[model samples]
Target chain A: SQTIHQWPATLVQPVGSPLSLECTVEGTSNPNLYWYRQAAGRGLQLLFYSVGIGQISSEVPQNLSASRPQDRQFILSSKKLLLSDSGFYLCAWSVWEHFGDTEAFFGQGTRLTVV
Target chain B: SQQGEEDPQALSIQEGENATMNCSYKTSINNLQWYRQNSGRGLVHLILIRSNEREKHSGRLRVTLDTSKKSSSLLITASRAADTASYFCATEGNAGGTSYGKLTFGQGTILTVHP
Candidate 1:
């Protein structure tokens, strides 16, 4: 059984503050990791995804960035948060496979309130 | 731009009634997946249907895919109040671009099942 852990579960930070959200997966190695953000009552936006360590792909230009420091450890960071950056951030993982039949598993998201 | 779009942005139904949601996508896909999200929580992967498959079932959930129509539908039978949540559809394109295995999500359908 694989499990993903994300923290802090909720955060309240002032504008322009630095931010760091970590996600780690256990019981799996070399899995694909992704970072996503969802606005209030809106669809999810892909932030970043990594197929392997030290590799990251950005889907859209935004104030946030992601990194894969270890095989199962992914981190989302922001040097300076914007009001628009406030949203629910999520981390997900899937087994790296050919192309199909891969299902992603998500962690309990981090709700960031930038005031 | 979103690759997938879910219809009926919001749905309200009584418990035990069946809930159906449709999703449409623009490009060729390797597979399409349905996910469920409780309020303020991360998504849970519910079902995945490959492009070659027309229908799939898991317990009370049934998924149908139409490659010709470029659309998919998720059916929840005998829905319960616990099924009240947002449902999203994600697509993994078959096109061997750099975005392979990177799922593009649709604006979800908010399902409200009354007890």
Candidate 2:
């Protein structure tokens, strides 16, 4: 069984402050990792994804960045936070397989508020 | 982008009643997946239906996919108050060649099952 964990369940940061959110998955190796943000009353917007260590792909360019330093550890960071950066951030992962559907599982998520 | 759109953006139903939500996407897909998210939390995968399959069931969830119509529906039988959450449909992209884990999700349907 694989479980995803995220830290700082709720955060309140001042504008222009730095931000760092961590995510890690246990019981899975080299699983695909993803970062998503959900705006109020909107859909989940993909920000970044990683296939393996040192491999990160950005889906949308914004005030956020993601890094995978280890196979099971992923981090989302920003040098300075913006007001628009406030949202529910989620980390997810799925097994790497070809052809057919591999479902992605999500973590508990972190809610960030920028003032 | 290549996202799906969920119909009946919001649904309210009483407990013990059935709730159905529909999602329509553009282009072809390898599979369609449904997920549920409680307020300010990560999404929980409910079910996945492959393109070749027309239906799937898990617990009280029933999912149906129609390739010709490029749409799918999720039915929750005997809904409970705990089932109140936002439901989203995600589709695996139809890019040629190898398939990456690029999932475009719908705006989502908010379901409120009152007791």
**TM per prediction:** 0.96, 0.95
Clashes by residue pair, model 2: none
Docking class of 2: medium
* Per-residue lDDT of candidate 2, residues A22-110 (tens digit): 99999988899999888888888888988889998998878888899999999999999999999999999998575767789999989
Best by lDDT: 1
How well does each candidate reproduce the native contacts, as fnat? 0.61, 0.58
- Scored by Cα lDDT, where does model 1 land? 0.92
Candidate number with greatest TM-score: 1
lDDT of 1 at A2: 93
Model 1, B4-47: lDDT tens per residue? 88999999999999999999999998899999999999999999
lDDT of 2 by residue, B1-115 (tens): 5378998999999999999999999988888999999888889988988889999999999999999999999999999999999999999876776455667889999999999
Clashes of each: 0, 0
RMSD in Å for model 1 = 1.2
Q: Considering summed lDDT, which 10 consecutive residues are worst modelled in model 1 chain B?
A: B93-102
| DockQ of the two-chain complex in candidate 2 | 0.68
